[model samples]
Target: MATICISTVLNFRLRKPRGFCCSLSSHDKMKNNNKRETPELLKIAVSGITELLRIFSSSKDQRLDTVTYTQKDQPLVSGIEDIVDILQSDYENAYFLTGNFTSSIYAEDCSFEDPTIKFRGKDLYARNLKLLVPFFDCPSLSLQQIQKVVSSDKSCVLATWKLRTYLKLPWRPLISIEGNTVYDLDDDFKIARHAESWNVSALEAVGQIFTPGT
Candidate 1:
């Protein structure tokens, strides 16, 4: 449960109506009228503040029974559990490498970028993953950390991960890369953009030519 406290200050100014026979110029009278309107301005300000307090109070009541994640709950994101499940099954699921992600978790116009490629549209993204699947054996993606950010119109998930696999060369060296990925979700909560950063360069990855145990 969350609590909100609102403090309001009220300012009052009392003014008596001026006589029409006053000798002051029109400009002077206008200034006096403006001074008299301070109470009205304060009324508007108080109304706005009251409405804001009401809104906050209502929101707190509605969320009282719900569990909210604070900064202490690191690596938290809405719908992240499902996304993790999908990623964990990706190595064994041909559909994940093919087009399943397109209709399931990704927006049709999603964009994806990594060290080697940058592209938009779910179809092309799925195609790229399919093409890369054949060059690796026993690939695994493990999530090391996750963080969620909510904004006015969209939400994002940042994940630190490690990808482990053996390149299908004659030596079949075991290669492991630590990387981070940012996934942006659209209004419907489908992945709209995905970008990855790797700790090692592509050339460095290619240099791992010998099997680890050999």
Candidate 2:
């Protein structure tokens, strides 16, 4: 949840200039250009190292502190059928990406978790979603499938989705994640836990932030 602002390292495949090393003046010009870029490249490298250090030094619980949670009016979900309908409608519009989710269907202390972080409190989750708003460029969440699963002992809603977004970085890195969420309903039929599983490993997902656009 740290708002990372590190620039991705660029790999340039420079083609050899025609008649390279034909003149001493040309070689000197190239050296000057390299010198001019060295500082900028160093800055980028430093920023990237700092960001990673911050991520690793902080505990998962500490990361939640970075998000700002604002209290909002809480409402109740009528029933299981109603919750399903609301979710279907909200997901179609990518409510999560826009921070426009209906907070009523979730308990005040509903737990949320994806590959990166886990925490309790619906307000915190909502605020965290809002944090991504500034950095998101053409974000999309496609709901592949959704269903209510009921069993003798457990009942929940399982929804599969694909999320794609371009982070507003200089490199225009793309974050593409295919995942599913399990919304566990409490006895009162309110969502108590929203757990997600991604197709890629956690490290791979993190790596996506540093990769150039595909």
- lDDT per residue, candidate 2, 172-201, as tens digits? 888776655667788888888886555554
Error of model 2, residue 108, in angstroms: 0.5
Worst 10 residues of 2 by lDDT: 8-17
Best by TM-score: 2
Runs off by more than 4 Å, candidate 2: 1-77
**What lDDT tens digits, residue by residue, belong to model 1 across residues 1-214?**
0101111111100112222112223224333333322234444554455345545544656542232322221223357555555544442343322323324566778876443333477655443343344455676666666666666655666555666666565655666666555667776667777765555534344345343424
Q: TM-score, each model?
A: 0.51, 0.65
Q: Estimate candidate 1's alpha-carbon lDDT, on a 0 to 1 scale.
A: 0.45
Reference-based lDDT, each prediction: 0.45, 0.58
Candidate 1, residue 105: Cα displacement in angstroms equals: 1.9
Give the C-alpha miss distance for residue 124 in model 2, angstroms.
0.6
